[model samples]
Target chain A: MLRINNLHVKIEGKQILNGLDLTVNAGEVHAIMGPNGSGKSTLSHVLAGREGYEVTDGQVLFNAENLLQLSPEQRAHKGVFLAMQYPVELPGVNNMTFIRESINAIRRARGQDEFNTLEFLQLIREKAAQLQLDEKLLKRNVNAGFSGGEKKRNEVLQMAMLEPQLAILDETDSGLDIDALRVIAQGVNSLRSAERSIILVTHYQRLLEYIQPDFVHVLVNGRIVRSGDKQLALTLEQKGYNWIIEEDAA
Target chain B: MKSPVQNAQLQTPQQRQQLQREWFQQLVVGAEVDAEYDPDWLLPLREKALQSISTLPLLNRKQEAWRYNRVDNIFQNSFDPLFDNDLEQKICIEDIGLPAIDSYRLVFINGRIDLSLSELSELPAGVILTGTAEALRTIPDQLMSSFDHLHQPGEQLFTALNTALFNDGVYLHVNQSVTLDRPVEIIYLNNNLTRSEQHVGSMIQTRNIIDLESGASATVIEHFISNNKHEKYFHNNFTDINLADDSRLRHYRIQDESRLAYHLSNVQITQHRRSRYFSTCLAFGGLWSKSAVRVEFQAQQAECDLLGLYTVGDQQLTDFHLDVQHRVPSCRSSEQFKGILYGRGRAVFDGRILVDRQAQHSDAALTNDNLLLVRDAEVNTKPQLEIYADDVKCSHGTTVGRLDPEQLFYMRSRGIAEHSARKMLCQGFATDIIESFELQQLRDYASEKIAHTLNSVESEMEHKNGH
Candidate 1:
């Protein structure tokens, strides 16, 4: 469902992602693990089509379409979703209104009928119940004063509503407590299907315990130095990224 | 009344002044002291007003209050003072298009009370609702004592101009302890019928006085509208409100004038002990408009809330100047004003809150927020707080910014179009102030008008961009 070929990206003349490559097929979950400054978040931003990043070389293809050619909103409409590391706080936009607009927008782009208010309310209630989210939070401004855990849950709620073909969770577990992590993992697990793919990007190996990945890639200095099965995640959790760097140097 | 035309020949400053003097002389010619209907006491007040306005020079940009506005250019076009005594022209209340509320409706055409168009039979006992001229004859003592106290003539150029030339206006007197069930509506309709051959602009000046006796409560809505969009006119309006002890007044003023018109209004309010005053102003139209509000708390525990929203586009200019004074202790005042400027439009907001030396425990807050859609649009906001008391809580904040780029991107990323995202943010910015209105109908009306303005401006800009 997603492919990155020698992705070389730079911000303000400082290269962040250099010669990085990854591939994920439908019905597969991949965990990209790295230490600080390993370009984990940079790869997510490039896939999400955020501006200010210079793509000096190579390309990203999503479902056989050249993702770099599309705008941010165009990428979104084409079934590409990015659960931001830090979800923005919109002061005046209501939570329910924002989510409804997002769902309807994507649906409209795909030539689908929009959901009425009643239909949306029912869908949101069911999804929110699955995630154990407070229904009252839907009436407040979008993450304006939400707690850290609530913000993460809200992002998961959005993912459930959007139902994108490829979902990139960037640091989704960075600020979550253990309970929140389990609930988020549960939400992600519920969306697993034969035609959907998810890319989990994090520094810790704890999230891999809740929703195990089919592939684990160790990234360092903007390059994937190791690719293995789920056992690699357990190995890195015991020894950290130093051994991986040593092995790459050898 | 014959329309006065401007001389086509080039004139010097002395010649212009001479023309102005001649026009003033013609206005008061036969009506100098005892203009047939003038009461014996009102004659001297009019004479004093005329004497004051005759010498008070037109405001130049040099003055602090008029610095940001082009006051001199508004007077360049010669205007004849409109005095329409044609009481025979019948007007249907349904045609006015206002919400049909069960209240006393006082309608004025060209600054004179339209007796045939007004309905006042349902007024409650002890509640006086009539034209100012009639109030002067029937409630002479009440009018005499409060008129001078509420309105200070010659304090400003337009106030004196309206005082010396105004023909008639609405007078609302709520007697002591009287609580009105329904709001009183005062509609000022400018219907300029001057022929093209005359080629003169009409000037409409009027005053509305509302006095709430001790413990009385009422709501008043002042609506100013124009029938002809192409008519060129100058409307100078003055509203004086006095809230006595324990009384409350919710006052709303809506200014929707012609696009070619100039509107200048002054609202002066005085609050006594334990009195409360709430004012909401929505300014949507006019080529050049300014509304100056001055409020004073004369006794302890008085409270006031001032909320305003103004939208201007396509070379329009709107200005708001609010001055609130806390004279006694334990008083509170809050002011929130928001503006949205599109095209090459410009706006100015000057809000000042003063706490007297003896006004301990005075709490005051003032905020002015403006949004400029296009690069050429400009706004000048100044929030000033002058507190002489040591134990007072006063804060003022002003913000001038374009729509948040991140917010826009967030909305756009959800597959919403860019233009729609901007419209949502703009509406959110303006609706915050419109929702402050206590009347639901007014809130809905103002919201619809703002949305219409935003839609037209957005489409026009998009068209200009050839999108």
Candidate 2:
């Protein structure tokens, strides 16, 4: 469903990603594990087409279409989703109104009919209920004054609303408690299907205990140094990335 | 409305002072309290004001004009007008948050003009962009004549007070058939921080006069700002504009002062035959700000457009009194004023347009709308149209409303677009007026400031709710 080849990214003239390669097929769940400053978030941001990043040498393909040439909104229209590490606070803008506009814009770009008001309300309410987010929270500004757990769940709620084909959850478990982790994992589990793929990017192996991944890749220095099955996560949790770094150095 | 006190040939300061002394002695005004700080030319006017008030009848409830006004509202104030802070240190134009656009820039801090910060040395020929002090020295007769149509001292005491003690302001005159290539920016920054601790409030009175001769055109932006956040002061500003036949003037004003300041402003504009006047006023600051705008159409084929936007929050009050008069036939005028009230903010808008019987074929429309963001906020708006012309088309409308509860209840949207959301929020109410601004940078800056204010109010509300 997605491919990244020789992705070398730099931010403000400092290289972050160096010759990274990764590929995921349909219905595959991949767990990308790395320590701090290991370019894990960089991969997610690059895929989402955020500005201020210079991709000196890289190629990204989504469904065999060049993704680097598209704008951020165009990437979203093509079913590329990045659950941000820190969801931005948008004051004054109504949360629901923004979501509706985003959905309609993407739908319009995809040549699909926009959702009716009543239909949209019903759909959003059902999805929000499944994630255990209060209906009152849906009324507030997007990510404005939201708690850490609430922010994670809100990201999950948006993911459910957009229903993208390739969803990358970036550091979703970084600040969440166990209950929030379980709720988010459950939401992701329910959305998984034969045609949908998910990339769970994290620094710890705790999130994998809730939702099992088919593949585990340890990314160090912008490149995947090791790839194995779900058992690889357990092994890395026992022996931290320090040993892996030493191994890479050796 | 022209005054009959027409005198000329007082060419020097001493000559004008002598003439004022002669007039003062002839008036036989006896009620004199200390006048050491008063200027020679203004002493006579102040005494004339006192004489006019002393000759008035006692106040009565039956009097329509005095029905609601207290004597103290006009004549009472503790603010001193003698806090002269001669700050010679020049500051950059960008330090005040105004873009350094290519224009004639005038900067005044503490009522004193800063030549180092001003860019008026290279004005085009036939254009005069100067301070009121220089104008008084050069064209005292013309400057005083511009205010001939103003209300008498007994009628509007604040205006008379301004005339009696106006420190400094802008004076721009475009000669016949001349067109200014760029707009003139007059920035007034009142920051008497040294006296704020002493509980002494300084009074800042500024008067501006703009004259456009026949077939002349110019644009002027008057910006009032306060540097210290907790500055305590009183600002009274009066502006007079005159457009001759076939002349045009676009006047834009912005008042973003400290919340602890009290502000009063009056703008009087007169349009002659076939002249055009466009005014955009944004009132976003000051604890208690009151503005009165009057536009008069004196001849046929004249047009005027008035646009105002005001936002008040948290113990703030903003009042606007708009009056438009169409005295000639085939004249046109339209006015739109919008307000945003949040967090116990109070706003009052009283707009009135009068079309005389001689003003046949006059087209006029006035609308005032207010958006209340909180239940505790208040907005009182009234738009009145009194048309005596049978062949005129006049309509007036006013609305005081809140944000849609039903729409705000559905804030959980699909993944959001921050830029689009902010634009949409500002577009909901402010787009109409902000878009009408002909300057691109000014429009964009206003939009960004509105967004910043919205965020601040929202966060403040959240903190209140949290407590």
Candidate 3:
């Protein structure tokens, strides 16, 4: 349940998202694939309410509310999750403690009971097991010395814990190894439900083979130039963004 | 504590020399050695100290060690001897909250050892834990011989004054080869309720010369606390540690004075062949606190671990000046000092590591990191490495910065308030030093104190804004 009409976004007074229109119904996984500078990441960040992305001329409607007006944390509390392309490394914040606090904060804001230490430990064990993550990583400082693959796994683990109503995965496959990519895709697949919608933004079609997005939209020059079913991803992989670029030019 | 001795007024060179002559005569009279206790072997040292005291002018800010420190106040206060009495003799050991240590316990109320509550019964034979005043009367030869061995009088105003007028102190002597597992706890309480001037001068001389006999290890914790929250207080103290061959010593100092108290202490340590010395200093409270540590690696294969943590708030000031000297070859020293400044508080750290000319293959390191939480809070950090040997690995680094904005934003974005985020980041900056403490109870207590102080400042600011 998300809708954007004529979403024209400008960052630093430079137009990024120009008259873009997109909608994703609940239970649908939408893949927005594009070349560099196509506003793919900008769309995800704008929806997630990151600062400095001035909404010059657009409205993002999520569950009949203006998502742009909410602060980043408020947006998070309202079930808007953004799995950043590069997760920030917080040196002293323990991974488990941070995840627990984040979940509890959102839950408290949403009028839910908070999890105690034992409950939190149990919850993290279950989630980590689901992601096939090492339990030892949960005790370390958040991504202090984590490898590239480990960081992506951590983000997916958080997404599972937060269980956002609408999830936006930005370039989640950018730095993942083949095995890590499979594990991460599996984690994301397990979290899919009829009540939750996920917007997968990527430049590679490798991750599409696993999570299997329902709709594939080719983004060119900050606009969705083509929309098709899952086979669109296969065609784009067989041929490349160059064909779409030439077709858009014609 | 009473005011320390003021120096002669600055004058012309001719006038200064004349003042020096007069001060020398006065110092000789003031330093009249006790009869029947003076050692012939220590005669040269006493004479040298007398001459140094007379010739060496009081420390001025011009000296690199005292560069950022306010020595003018010390120069304005004249030395006033403190008299010990039962008026302030009350001390609840439970309130002190010291970890249980083996061996006798001696409590110093305003610098005089409280022998009534001391447990001297468990001390090994020939081990002494008595007042210096009485020790001099009983064994004058031993006390005089070791006095000023590690420290010279008059070199530092406080140390010189201590030598001239130390009425009472703790004299701990571990018999040779005594493998004492228990550490002696010396609690110096500076409660300024005595109505008398508070000038605390106590020297701890450990001569156990524990020739660890090749593999013996012992840990000693020396605690200094001044909870007095009033004016008219001074703490001028010194500690001289002499470790024999193959011996190990762990020294810990906890100095938490009130906002109106002054803390000045000198720690001089000398290590023999293969002797290990470790120091952990935690100074969390004081209006004006300054400490100097001079460690000499007198023999080869010696190791020293120097760690310190100081947290200041309000207009409080804390200064730490340390010199890790590598006199012999193959010595190693690792130093780390972290400080947090809030309110209008200020902190200064001048750490110097000196590698002697012949002391090759020495590894020395010094690091000082400071975090400023408020605009008015200030930190002056200087890490100096004086290396005369080319083969030594000597590195010094100093960093003074505020909390990371990105980290702060991340924490706040998690719904943790801005104040909580700042406090957590500040605590994280100090955790490196706090984690070094082996005692979990002390570590937890220190962490809580630091966090509480940080939050207190934040709340006070919030309240002021609310008004």
Output the number of the TM-score-best candidate: 1
Which pairs, if any, clash in model 2? Answer: A95-B411, A95-B413, A96-B411, A96-B412, A96-B413, A99-B413, A99-B414
Q: What is each candidate's DockQ, to 2 decimals?
A: 0.51, 0.08, 0.31
TM-score of 2: 0.60
| TM-scores for candidates 1 onward, in order | 0.91, 0.60, 0.85
Q: Candidate 1: list runs displaced more than 4 Å.
A: A243-250, B1-35, B85-103, B149-155, B192-199
Output candidate 1 Cα RMSD: 3.4
Q: Name the runs in model 3 displaced over 4 angstroms.
A: A1-24, A42-71, A217-228, A242-250, B1-55, B73-80, B96-104, B117-121, B124-131, B149-155, B194-216, B413-415, B464-467
- Per-residue CA lDDT of model 2 for B164-224, tens digit only, reads 5576678899999999999999898886444633544567777888999999999888888
Grade the docking of candidate 3.
acceptable
Top DockQ model: 1
* C-alpha lDDT of residue B187 in model 1: 88
lDDT of each: 0.83, 0.78, 0.75
TM-score: the better of candidates 2 and 3: 3
Task: Evaluate residue B239 in candidate 3 and report its C-alpha lDDT on the 0 to 100 scale.
Answer: 65
Candidate 3, residues B86-163, lDDT tens digits: the string is 563466766765555554577777666677757667666645667666766677676653465434332354555455
DockQ of 1: 0.51
Candidate 1 chain A, poorest ten consecutive residues by summed lDDT: A85-94
Name the TM-score of candidate 3.
0.85
Determine the iRMS, in angstroms, of model 2: 8.2
Q: What are the candidates' interface root-mean-square deviations?
A: 1.7, 8.2, 2.6
